[model samples]
Target: MSNSARILIVDVEPHIRRLLHGTLTRADYRVTEAGSARQAMAEIEANAPDVVLLDLGLPDRDGLELLPLIQQKSKAAVLIVSARDATDEKVAALDLGAIDYVTKPFDTEELLARVRVALRSRLVADGGRASIEAGDVSIDLVQRRIHKKGEEVHLTPKEFAVVAELARFPGRVITHDKLLAAVWPRDYERHIEYLRVIVRNIRQKLEDDATVPAIIVNELGVGYRLMGVAG
Candidate 1:
């Protein structure tokens, strides 16, 4: 875990900001704190952190509005750390291009894990280090390639698209509809099997221990996500 991976912690609470600052700093992650949307935008413009931990309730403007602006300015991954755990809120954040969301009173370890996964995928996007290797598996989104140990692995066009899409976002739980639309077309949004079969294949190829997959994981009825990476 390199301190080079920077994260912006946006929270209205002073204690929350302080706790995150201390926790992240001790874990060797470069962290920037912002208490308002205005300050968050400013910090994002100046430093361009790799990932943003955003709170929906901001003092000035709605944090959700800043999502598009943040994405437009920089390719930083935004994770909404809000107390709003409603289904609509989660879906809205995901649809608006946020990578993930964590409600208040969340587990610190889970939050850090999501941050790590988001940073890893962002690293791939930034072309810093494109390939991710874990155990015997490797995923290369740039080259549209995958390999197990030293051997090359082949996949169909649709299969590759699904794998690439999920792996690109790492810990982000992309919904089944979202995956279908991105891979197939807007019309195939209801085809759940399209995601399921491809996911099964990807797991079989990448997971050294298929029974306990480390590369890609399921989110039950929600969607699939690529997990287990460092921030």
Candidate 2:
């Protein structure tokens, strides 16, 4: 395996593991395979990968049960790759700290793209600098500054905090509760309107058009995601 980026495929099916290994290897990612939750844990402890493609139907244990354990042991990003397509299952995985979810029979290009996004998020999280860039927008966490096209873009402190939080995870969705708890004091955690207002203000300053936004997109009723960012 090359050192470009390590990806662990946690699927019980040998053919599925082989398929993912080939695809990821061709794309320059080092691949590891785990046929069960126990093996997955061992692999994670022995060598933490940059991203984990987890299948929920592990033989030794339910994959969701291992999500937090994985997070506790390593900084690798968890991306659920399962055949279970229930909305509740997706929400449960995301709520339990999985960064992204991809159902079985997924498109190759889409899966690759999601993997790229997950890797980018992991890189940014581990990079130690809280700064991130998306297209023309640049966020400086240390300086608490934002610039668009090399020009400074002024934002309220609250608005800047919101953007900064979103930038930390880049392309991943930050749920409404997570953003609220992160940005506001405990007493204001339920104030979803505050998030909405701050997001609106951020778009007005950072995006070309707030109406048809391209940078920060709403995940319907769930949360918001920072789009088009690279690691």
Candidate 3:
């Protein structure tokens, strides 16, 4: 909705870059173009764009390999726009910190919608938001507080840390290793049971029905997901 958002389009094809530049400029967004991973990184370093429309097939390096590097460079949200539509590739990209993914030949409206979501979330993170409203609960990331339907829900410091980590990346899957490393700073490999116990306690306290969890969803052996990030 905001016309002031800046977008960087990274693709190997010249025509694709030209087409995206026209489409985004017509949509009233400031646009930048890069034809290779090296160029993309250069643009990112010189000035970080608000959102990056990245193509996985790059001439210099694979987009998958460059995704994390981009994250390391800036706080910009990455929306993958590649022709690789395989489920595994999508999962891999999201797991690597991509805000969202769109396959090539993507619908104009749908792609724009996803971009809007990414921009909105960036606004939330950048506006000094020390809290999040998820469903009936409010998470105060600053104070590490949780209130359910106007009532305080107490939790241990460790429990709060786990929930906060997942909340940090809404609508994105956080792999087991990433979560464990974040929460269990010292050693996390042998502490899945500890994480599980804490997650169970969190669910019992916050979830309406712990048996059928809605706020915190488990990704089988991967990690937990914080649902209802809309607050």
TM-score of each predicted structure versus truth: 0.55, 0.56, 0.54
Q: What does the lDDT read for residue 183 in candidate 3?
A: 57
* Collision count for each candidate, in order: 1, 0, 2
Looking at candidate 3, the ten consecutive residues that score lowest on lDDT are 122-131
Candidate 1 lDDT for residue 179? 84
Summarize candidate 1's per-residue lDDT along 1-231 as a digit string, tens digits.
321357899999999999888887877777999999889989987776778999999999888787888898777889898989899989988899898888888888888888877876676665445566645667765444678877988877677767766766667888888788756754735588867888788777777877798777788999887777545
Q: Model 1 residue 156 lDDT?
A: 71
Predictions in order: lDDT: 0.78, 0.84, 0.81
User: What C-alpha RMSD separates each model from the true structure?
Assistant: 13.5, 13.1, 12.5
lDDT of 2 by residue, 1-231 (tens): 222457899999999999899898888777889999999998987666778999999998999999999999888999999999999999999999898999998887888899888876775665434567888898765445689999988887567767867887789898998888656745646698989999998899889888999999999999999997867
Clashing pairs in 3: 133-231, 134-231
Arranged by TM-score, best first: 2, 1, 3
Between candidates 1 and 3, the one scoring higher on lDDT is 3
List the candidate 3 regions with Cα displacement exceeding 4 Å: 1-3, 127-231
